[model samples]
Target: MQASRTLSRSGVAVATARPVLQFLAIMLIALVAGSTFGIWRGYDPGGYSALTFLETLQGAVGGLNVTLPLMGAGALVMTGILAVMARRDRPVAVAYAFAFVLMAVAAVITRFANQPINADVVTWTPDSMPANWTAIRDVWWHWHVVRTMLSMLGLAVLVLAIMADRNRSSAPSA
Candidate 1:
């Protein structure tokens, strides 16, 4: 009976830990991918290279196209599965649960907010895009910034929940 109880408790820990880890993994992956493109294509006011800029832009678009969907789907499915398993009374579990939902929101923003801007950019010519483009770019940029920040914040919450779960697991039972 004691062994069975211990096993069941460990099972709970495993179920909770799996989703949190998956969330962190996806967030970290997105962060790395985003940072990579940012480093390669980041704005420098004094430096200008049309060729290099175009190449870096291509890399950025491609990176987003691949990583965002994969991470989004994995997070969504894992979160839904874990949500059903997590107890409502556990605050830490709830935080981790919400992280997955935040990721889904981020994905939608990327598709709706960012992709349209990217499409416009791709269709633009240097001469043609300048007309009223700044205002359009600003709105899209703001949304992108918000989505990225929210995703990072959600990932942080998931990390905290995982750490709390770990600490709880390590404590001596009464």
Candidate 2:
């Protein structure tokens, strides 16, 4: 009876934990991919002509068409899980909520500060690149870094939350 009960509890814990793990894994992958591109573009700002830049941007956006929805869905499911966990574990819930908030801020920064610049860049032609093209690229890189940092911070918070959950689960009950 005791062994069976322990097994049951372990199963429940795994079930609760899987979604959080999935969310963190997906976010980390996205972070790695985004950072790679951002760093490359940052160092080689003039490496691409306007047409090449636009092509690269289109390809990147096409890639995001797949990743962004997956990340967003993972985030939403994780948030829902945290919301349910809130009833039993307020601190853990709050930690997860903070993680969610950070991610939300990142998304907002991407939409408002990054997308407009992307739109402008996409419209540019090699023959008619903007006079202030450097400024636009600089601003885009700045916001991309900001959003990337926010996402990484969120991932860190989520990892902390998972650690807390593990500690709480392992501790003996009074």
Candidate 3:
């Protein structure tokens, strides 16, 4: 009787673990993507003064300094756990792997392309703002667009992978 109870509890754990992992990965990446989208749409400067722009950017950088890295790390860890758990299932594993790679690419874009500019933008005052600020801002904006698209795609891919995994799990046995 004790052995049977232990087995039942194990079964319950296995059943719920995957759902929790999926939820974590999806929600974290969704938050990162959603926040990026909001920034692109609502905070593009639109001809604001250099001081005003730098102030807004400083506020944005402050929040993102905490939020983006945490969300990206959580999403990657959860997706990697899912991928490892699905390793015996080739298609599902591959889908999760692809999702991880896509998200990693987005992170790379953020780290290498976008963040240096953010750091500099946060340091500038109206008097100290670079004479070539327009060019710098345009470049930052372009990379922001790229990461935004990549993150959105990564989220979509992760969702599709979850659906595929569920469908395969529920399919009738051969």
Which consecutive 10 residues in model 3 have the weakest lDDT in total? Answer: 45-54
By the TM-score metric, which is better: model 2 or model 3? Answer: 3
Q: Candidate 3: give the clashing pairs.
A: none
Predictions in order: lDDT: 0.62, 0.67, 0.89
Model 2 clash tally, residue pairs: 0
Over the stretch 1-174, how does candidate 1's per-residue lDDT look in tens digits?
999999999988886676565565556535633653454346421243444434444556666666766766665665555555556538756866777667667778878887887766666555555565556656665766667666766666656666665566577989
What range of 10 consecutive residues in model 1 has the weakest lDDT sum?
Answer: 44-53
Output candidate 1 Cα RMSD.
4.8
User: Candidate 2: which stretches are off by over 4 Å?
Assistant: 1-55
Per-candidate TM-scores read 0.67, 0.71, 0.89
Better of 1 and 2 by TM-score: 2
Better of 1 and 3 by lDDT: 3
- Full ranking by TM-score: 3, 2, 1
